[model samples]
Target: MNKSNIYQCADCHTGSGTPQALQAPKVRTHLPSVTNYSCTDCHSKVVVNAGPTAANVTAHYAIRPTVPTSNYCDYCHGPNATSPFPARNKTIPQFAHDDPGWDGNATCRTCHTNSSVSADPLANDTSSFHELTTEYGDAFNGSVKADCVVCHVQKSPQFVAAPNPPHDISGMAAPDCYGCHGVNVPGTEAQKLHNPTPTTTGGCIACHSNNATRYYVNKSLFALHANVNTTDGMNNVTDADCKTCHHGAADGTMGMKLGAANSSNTYFCQDCHTSAGTGPTHPSDPNLIKDGLSHGKTDCRWCHLAGDSQPRPLSSQLRYHPNGPRGTAAGKNCLSCHVSANLPDPPFHAPGESHVSDLNACQECHSNADNHAVTPLTQNTPPLVSGLSVSTQITSGTPSQVQFTVSDPMLQIAAAQYQVTNSSGIVFDWTNMTGTFNSNSVTINANIDTSGLVGNYTVNVKGMKSAPRTDPSKPYYPLNGQWSSISNAQLNVIQPTGYDNGTVYGTLGTDIAGATVSTNTGVSTIANSSGFYSLSLTNGTYQLTASKDPEYYPNSSVFVTVTAFTTITQNIILTPKPTGNISGTVTSK
Candidate 1:
């Protein structure tokens, strides 16, 4: 090698030791304790060219200490190795050399070295070594150490360095439990890890021993933890009892340990917070059942509003809980699930006639928590109307009937009424009707007079507990303040009667009596002795004709328009047949 090509110690090493070495030494991004080794520990090889070769430097420093398994490689390359020739253990698992920056791959120089002059393995690089601890520390925390078997089938590896401290379980909440164990408690793959059998010892063997010190645990143990027999709160457990399972040194008495070199040993408080019975279990707290009605005791959240940990205050749970059907946190009121479609299976009262569908008026039917056992019809509610109908189209100045059926739970319908509204939604007419009472419902027929009104209108009927009113300002108000649902029907009042009159005369100005005058609408009238014909029609174009059998030729088609309440006159001139038609034919030949 040329003299200028020789590498000096100051060219690669810096006094601060922050991985600022010029070449391959840049791979050490951070040296935690520099006092553990000296420069000669890695660069002990002496070359005839006055410097250590790149191959000699990387033979021991290629793989860093960040990898957990790298500790096995450090046993021989560390400063404690024998000076002349380090003893190597072949029993340690060997990593593939194709892994970049891990073995003898050429790509290791991309992140390990910074030199461009040399053609060695650690040469011509743009990147420097990055510390794994600084980039991914939170992911490898103590909590996730137990979750390693979720992805990797191989057990966790041993750590030569000190391990991270255990997580504080006090700050955890409900979601933290379901997040690791999964949403469906006994349904996820994590369930097998929670209560593993000796035959199916997949990941549990890491914490539990399967030999002479075997510990038998199964799903039934979770039930034992929940059946404390006290309804006051979580009892039969103390701070001292928790230490035996969670803290303390691992003894052969229990198959659990505080630490393991190659497997998970972490435990959680949710391992025992599950409910255990076939039917209704004990309430989370005694005060949660002060109401006479039964809120669901089978679900833990019915009393423990927070879903996990200690139960919330009694006042808080009751204020936010709802009655049966869906007794969860989303149900905040009795009517939230007590609708007609989702009513109780046995039903509190008779069906059909005894049911009232109310979204906001549940108190009018049931007594709520005050007296839920009483009969439902103890209180009166608004009436309901059904089968409302009227003629869709009618002539002006005509009379029509509006009919409907009204029913009340308390049978207190005192009066029924109907009203007519114009096209502009204005009520112009209101009338009262007499109702014939049957069993629980009443039938009503209201006679309405359109009189002079000519427009589209809507007719509505309603029942009330008080006398009906005609006051325009309060047309819908019932005197006793109880009102029924307003049911409506459509009405169209057409144009009134108009006259189409005409005089039928012969070509010689002679009057033709008994002539028939008919319109296209199937309305016809005979001419009087004076040859005057008349017919009633509405406002529209119509085809008129005057006909008398075989006498003078009938005037076939004539068009005319009649306005409302007005008279239209048209004269019809009919031609008589020639009595001498036979004499003219002989002269043409």
Candidate 2:
């Protein structure tokens, strides 16, 4: 080939001199025709084909023209094609195309060599078909990677479906389908191998049906395992258990009378069993047997076995009810029924038992006969009179004397004795007299010295029966009753003469000035400065009149009296002012 005709070689070649015309220049008649291999080899550095196969030899081939031709480097390297590669390939190489280098397998250097290219090809051309991998980098590996199923056909198994439907007996086509339906769907061969009978209706019964001894047979077989031997077996059963299957049980059933039993068994058995009742017979009792006082019965559950469905007891045959086995006569003695053949010995009172006296009947100290009674030693003893009084009189300085009186009017002196103590607590007198007492009055001339004793003093009188007093022998003292009496009178010791001083002091005022003074039975004075005055008087009444002054007329008069030497204060108001008036008027235009 001619030297100039090798327009662009694969690599730059330089020769010093044409060595002696090694051969005549192999010039062809046609200008150096471009061979497909030579053109591709040179342009491969600028633009490369993707998936180069025979079928896409010319169809998908990408070409870069020489610098000066109409297909110049600038022609292919314009703003739209600055990279000397196909516009489509330069922009979005991910999408496959008919042009060789413009197909989806093109890389960054294919067009970007010695050219300013976008760091991202899809950065400017929003309409490009390219999908930049960096935009979805994290999504490809993160939580949303599974979202590919929403678009691409090959990515369908990535996500789970919502609101799972009933499982098919055949089986799930996709294993990922179990992500949502596993909790609800029955396994394909599970029913055929485990529960072949198809007795249950849904998923719950599929596994639970095998343990018939533990669970109910099915939803329809409500009463299959109704009776449980122990409470633990029927763990979750409740009154709702009956309502679950007996929706129409209240209406009626074969061989079952409904309305008649509603009054007796309207509520759950546990409701009545847990509560107390006052009927003559137990509500759970079919025979209507009665026990206890008045033939009233205790609750049936008090002595019988309990069940889950029914609160009634299992046992029925017995002579007496378990509760309240004895009558009121037995009191709290349990042996009255437990060991009736030979009764146990009665309980005894210990050493400190209470004592009672024969003077009083048992009822006197034992208020209630139903229980044991305890009486104190001083039962029915009358309270002693701590003081005395009288409304009777005696001559002054006569040294009056009187006898002490007992309080209990039914007491007889024949069986009692009396003692008197003076104000100083000294035993002044005592006596053991004998008589039939009609009243509590006793009069004996007993002297009391009034010479030096002046102020009020108290005298105490005490009485007791002679021989530990079993009973009241006379009417003066009553059995089983407390004492009563009238207190002594309060004596006022008085002397004859009394002396008292008398004077009166007061404030004075007047309606007008200068009231006159008078000295009759009491002393009086006229008004002074600021209508005020002073007066000294004996114990008598007097009157004073106002003397008229030139500036004002006489206003009013007042009366005064004096009793003892006391200060009598009073306020007087004056009413002196001008009584005349004047009138006038103004003239206007």
Q: Which numbered prediction scores highest in lDDT against the true structure?
A: 1
Reference-based lDDT, residue 395, model 1: 84
> What TM-score would every model get versus the actual structure?
0.26, 0.15
- Residue-level lDDT tens digits of model 2 in 1-589: 4434433332221122234443423322111142223434334544444644433223124343333322222233233434443422122212111122233222222121211222324323322111222223212333444221221122233222211222222222333222222223354322112112111233333433443323223333333223221243553333333332232332333111211122242332223323333222133443222232110012232222111113222122211112112212224221221122110111210011112223234346434222112222333545344334432243234463445555333222222233434456644344443433322333322455444333444433343321113443422112212333323434333221111212121223333335444444444566654445455554455554343344444433545565534555443443344567678887897
Tens digits of per-residue lDDT for model 1, 94-117: 222121222233222311231211
Alpha carbon lDDT at 180, candidate 2: 25
Model 1's lDDT to the true fold?
0.44
